[model samples]
Target: MRIYAVINQKGGVGKTTIDVNLGYGLAKSGKRVLLIDLDPQGHSTTVLGDQGAELTVKELFESGSKLGIKELAQPARVHGEVVENLDIVPSNIKLAVSAENLAARIHREKVLANALEKVKGDYDICLIDCPPTLGVLAVNGIFAADRFLIPVTYARYALDGVADLFGIISTVRETDEFNYTIIRNGYDSRTKTTNDFIEGQLEPFAANVAKTRIRKTETINQAAINAEPVFTFDAKGNGTADFEALTKEVVGLDA
Candidate 1:
């Protein structure tokens, strides 16, 4: 499978939002997609409308080879008989504590990679929404992924934190874990700060960045609050068009 983890060390950068919508966008284009929510916040699960998320990442982590990832996947909240190609492994708040507890164990950084190995090629694309921390679990997320994406919001961020995100990525490379792409998100070019960040700082980083940006839009906010991907909610909106572009970029990657 071509695994891509939608990751960033910062929260509220639209990581989960992008993951769900992009998964839907890709599925709409006929790619078999598997999206895993590694964020303990479970925003992906919640936004996807998974009220009764049967098995979580925690269950899968604790399951090891016992449960098997094929059986571990459940249809996303937005996924039904209609979107049979899209799958989700949900998450919950308990994962935060599970992560802390798992840290005390061996192979904590290898757990996710090992789990994913069980279902290596079951999907054409595996996208993971990683939590906003560089914990063992997050490292495991990177280790398991083949390629990844970093989402950054257009606003005042502690430059140190952005640097820290790259630091972690460098560490992943030092270990030869995975190569990744950084996606610039929530870019409101109207704002002075956003524009400055996009032009002055981020533009130079384009080689590591995505070709598209999810511009600031109310459609995205409304879609999240309604617990549905923008594709299922408003496929004709600008948000859907942008994500459709992202889907095309992803699909074109190894072609």
Candidate 2:
């Protein structure tokens, strides 16, 4: 299975939105998708229609926990209906404390990678929803992923701290074998100047930028509020179209 971590050091950049939507889109297209909610806030978990899961991703970070991904993962639901071929390893706020405790463990960063080894063949892709920080939990997500999916906003400060994130990835991998893609989220075509500015800023990473831009739309937020993906929330919405294009682009990428 190919693992992709949706991460960005800066918050409010649509990391969880992209992760959940992309995973569901892929699953609907006949791919087995496993989403690991690695964030302490558990936004992905809640968006997937899960609440208070007994075994969560939090247990994976705890030392000496025998729980495997199979045990932790459950069918993703939307409005009380199961989403076929999609599963999620839920998370909770307690994960923040677990992340702190993980710092003292030996081979802490590799813990997630090791856990995923046993179930590599179970799913076609594993999507990790990482927290908006360069902490131990994010490190574990980075170490476990084969590819990185970074979502950047249209704001001037969108690329802030991205260099630090790249530095950490380089420090961990120390090689160029891995691949990463930067996707512009919450794009507004009306603001030509801001769009041009953000586009100019992204010139350095042009090769890694995705052609599909997730447009700023209220349907996305509405779907999240209803605990459903755009596919189910509004099949013909702009959010659905953008995410569909993104799913195709991501699947075409070599991991």
Candidate 3:
């Protein structure tokens, strides 16, 4: 299975939004998708309509915890209905403590990669929603992923800290096979000045940027509030179309 870690050290850049939506989008396209919520805040878990799950990603990093992905993953639900072909390893606030505890362990960064090896055959794709920090947990996610999906906002400082993230990835993996794609989320084309400024900032990484610009839309927020993906909330909306295009891009259908 191909693993993609949806990460960005800078918060509020639509990492969780893209991860959840992209997972559901791929699932809708007949791919078995596994989403791992690595954030202590559990936004991806809540967004997937799972709250207070009995088993979470926390067990994967805990010392002596034998729980694997199969035991922790459950069929993702939306408004109390199961979403077919989509599963989630939920997370909770307690994960913050687990992250702290993981720091002292040997080969902590490889824990997730080792656990994921057991279930590689079960999923077509695995999406890891990493937290907004460059800590042990994020390192584990990065180490486990085959590729990285970075979501950048329209803000002027959106590219800040991205270089550091890439530096860490280079140090940990040390291979050209590991690559990344940057998607611009909540893009507003009407604001030419802001768009131009952000584009200028992204000039160095322009080749890595995705062609699909997720437009700024209220439908996304509404869908999130309802604890469902855009496909189920408003399939005909631009939000759904944008994510569908993104899914194709990720799967190489748009290439």
Candidate 4:
């Protein structure tokens, strides 16, 4: 399985949006996608049409290998069978408290990795929505993922927290062993600031940036409000097309 952690230390960069949409897009394309919501906020869990889940990702860490994937994972569905082939290991506020104890355990960084190993064979893709900080939880996420997909917003200080994320990657694993992709989210070509961010701030890391930028669109918010993917909620919209292109780019890179 290809495990990709959708992460950003800086909040409100659309990490949950990317995690849900990409997982939905891949699942719609006939790939079995499992989304693990590691964020205590549980935004990904709610957006993917799952709420009040009996089991969550925190239990996997607390119980360790005792709780298997089937026990923790709940189906990602909408209106019964409207959208299928996607499962989610939901998250709750308990995860924030669980993070404290994680550091005290042996090989704490690998806790998530070990939990994922038992279920990796069941799915074609795994997308982890990490917390918005470089804490113990995010550290566990980094160790578990095969690659990192970063969602960057267009702002003057867009690259501010990127150095901290890279530092974590450098410290834990071989930087080259895992690939990193930077996607420009909430992009508006009509704005000069967006253009400047692309040219001045993001240009230095051009090699890692995905060619496709997730353009700013109201349909994205609409989809979230409806608790469905942009593709399913508004297939004709630009948001769907952008994410489809992104999914293709991600899959091609894996190839």
The best candidate in terms of TM-score: 2
Report the number of the highest-lDDT candidate. Answer: 2
Q: Residues 148-231, candidate 2, lDDT per residue (tens digit)? A: 999999998999998899989987777655689999999998989999999999999999999999999999989988877888
Write candidate 3's Cα lDDT for 69-132 as tens digits: 9899999998778999999999999999999999999998999999999999999999999999
Deviation in Å, model 2, residue 33 alpha carbon: 0.3
Sorted by TM-score, highest first, which candidate order results?
2, 3, 4, 1
TM-score of each: 0.90, 0.97, 0.96, 0.94
Candidate 4, residues 148-222, lDDT tens digits: the string is 999988877777889888988878876645689998999887898667855687777889899999999999988
RMSD of 4: 1.7
The residue pairs found clashing in candidate 2 are: none
* Candidate 1: segments with Cα more than 4 A from true spot: 49-51, 63-65, 79-82, 158-160, 173-178
Tens-place lDDT per residue, model 1, 1-255, is: 888888878777788888888898888788888888888888888865363666678875663436656776887656443466888887888788778778787767777777778787777888888888898768888777778787777766723376676678668657634466767677676787657765567665667677887878899889888788888778799888889988899897756
Residue 27 in model 1: lDDT? 82
lDDT of each: 0.77, 0.91, 0.90, 0.84
Candidate 1 to truth, TM: 0.90
Backbone clashes in model 3, listed as residue pairs? none
Model 2 residue 123 CA deviation (Å) reads 0.5
